[model samples]
Target: MMQRNVGVVFGGVSPEHEVSIISALQAAAALDRARYRPVPIYIAKDGVWYTGDDRLLDPAAYRDLDRIRREATPVMLDPRSYRTLELVAAGGRRFARPARWSVDVLLLGLHGGPGENGGLQGLCEAFNVPYTGSGILGSALGMDKVLSKMLCRDQQIPIVDFVAFRESDWGYHEEAWLDRCEQELGYPVVVKPARLGSSIGISRAADRAALDAAIEEALRYDEKVVVERAVTALREINCSVLGDVHEAIPSVLEEPVRSAGQELLSFREKYLRGGGADGGKHARRPAKQPAGAEGMASLDRVIPAPLPPEKTAEIQALGVRIFQLFECSGVARIDFLMDGTTGQVYFNEINTIPGSFSFYLWEPTGVSFTDLTHRLIDLALKQHHDKNGRVRTYDVNLLSERSLQGLKGAKQRAG
Candidate 1:
């Protein structure tokens, strides 16, 4: 049984960079040793790419990222073959020989920004590399909060009332935008950067003053911002969907526990809470973790969500429906905001490459983290095969035809 090399891509020029590292490393650690070899492809905050087995695989090495990157090999893609993903070392390496590695599939652990947006997925498409999670279109849709909600609305999927605006619009028509939000969505709104995930740059504003501040804060993270009518009686629920939209299954729902005073899940609450020596007030972890360590699995949550069996089934069905609507492939986690009193479940957002791949949600469904990662790789390969099977290129060259000659003659005459 030859082992397939899996490149785990993470750590990007995003605010969630550290969290992406944790998610990527955890996924790498969970890869079945007998079946796959995990290769760490670390993208630094400055957009430089690095590769080092020791430096990347160990969580502690990231404590001093500058020194770690200095010790690691800077890598770039080999442009020789469009269909092959060959990683070669960049110049100015500490070692005389820079190692080159080949990967069968890419396991994306990126949390937000370009890494989770269509940018990275488009790169993968251009390279003809098989990557786990949603494809370019799905990723773009998932990242754009306004567009995603629009899609849901089109599909008759329930979502919370929201208004979206750009920084330019806010700056120029400040009173107009504020009036719209207040009139359409009202006060007690949730302000968020449209393209970010893991609850970064998300805030709940109760009145006009807080809404003004929240919108400003969110704009610092993204050009486009969304102000959603805050669900005062919000009960957040998340379900992970696996496989392609055509043939997929939903994992058990998990309700993430939020820290006090946090109306919405903050970055610290999502990734750092219950994570360190000081109860994760900061991500200041002790040097070593216990054996069988987990990342997102450590989040304080209730498995099966303590919901009625019927309600659980309903949410799972919606999860699958949304996954299919987005034409998502591989794995994605769809989060829902439920009105606890009314039992109304509204689609919140989708994480195309959810943190830790949402393996915790799958565990109770009889799938281990190892199995989950393996399936994601297998699904990526399947999607790649299907994509290549499509007719993407024209067989005949237009330059060789008489029509082209006529067009050229016409253009020359015009010139």
Candidate 2:
């Protein structure tokens, strides 16, 4: 049997570029050779696309990006056809030729911005190509924290109270808005950019002065900002969900332990090694655990989350609900914030394309990384097959007959 070609596209013009590279390389290395052929498509920080042996897994090689660019060959996907990802090669003393390579499916490892926030998904949809993760609407919704929270509210999913404001609104009525926020949500609020991830442009304000500063900080990253009541005694727990609108499954929950004086996991803590004192960097590395421990087996997670079975079930149920509500496909990691004392779980955010593809979470459930990648590729192919069967165009020529009649009516009305 012929192996399906899976194009894993990663690296982007997002703050999460380094994390995306780590996740993509991990996924590429885990693809089952017998069932699928993994093709690495690297997109540089400058938006250039490249594909070659130089794009293979090598963490140390990334520190010097200029060297990689010099060695790698340029590549691009043909928008005219979804089935092919063409390589643009320079011909000696002649015009460049378009060399094509067939792509059976797309495995997106993009983390934020254009890659995760519907831009790449929209491009794929334009070509009618099936890619893993959420569709355009779902991806957009998931990326925007404010919009996703609104949807969650409509779906009865519990989320922390938040106030959203546009940059223009803040600039025009700063004092009035500040008074309103203080009166309603009060101080000690969490300020975050509406669309960024990895805790970029996120800050906590303890008073009116701090609140003003936090909002200003957030505006630097995004035009829209959200202010919410901060969970001071917070326990960060995350669960991974898999499937589409009708069906979904949740992984075991894991608490992301933070270091002293760290209120939230910053981008530095997430990607930079040894950046923290309490081994925060090492916490992200892969780990081994006993059997039957579930998704928490591969990562440094306290198996079962040390919460009541009922509460654990509740979080998992909510994870499945959020996955279905957003119409997400393949896999996603849904994060939740629980009050350390009250056990009150509030929906934090959803990572449409999570780090390491959340493969570590599935390992404990007996799903190997290879199996997980294959599952996503199979889902993409199935979605493409189902979409092709739908009636996309009409046979009737309504424009042909209506053109003359419409023109005559328009001329009569104008006269």
- In model 2, which regions exceed 4 Å deviation? 90-98, 273-300, 396-415
- The local distance difference test score of model 1 is 0.82
**What's model 1's TM-score?**
0.92
Give the Å shift of residue 232 in candidate 2.
Answer: 3.2
What's the true lDDT of residue 343 in model 2? 82
Q: What does the lDDT read for residue 128 in candidate 1?
A: 92
What is the Å distance of residue 148 in model 1 from its true position? 0.9
Residue-level lDDT of model 2, residues 42-130, one tens digit each, is 78999887666523555445667776576665676675565544445322211112255567778898989999999999988888777
Give the per-residue lDDT digits (tens) of candidate 1, residues 68-127: 678778888874566557788776554222467787788888988888888898989988
Against the true structure, whose TM-score is highest?
Answer: 1
Off by over 4 Å in 1: 92-98, 275-294, 401-415
Give the best candidate by lDDT.
1
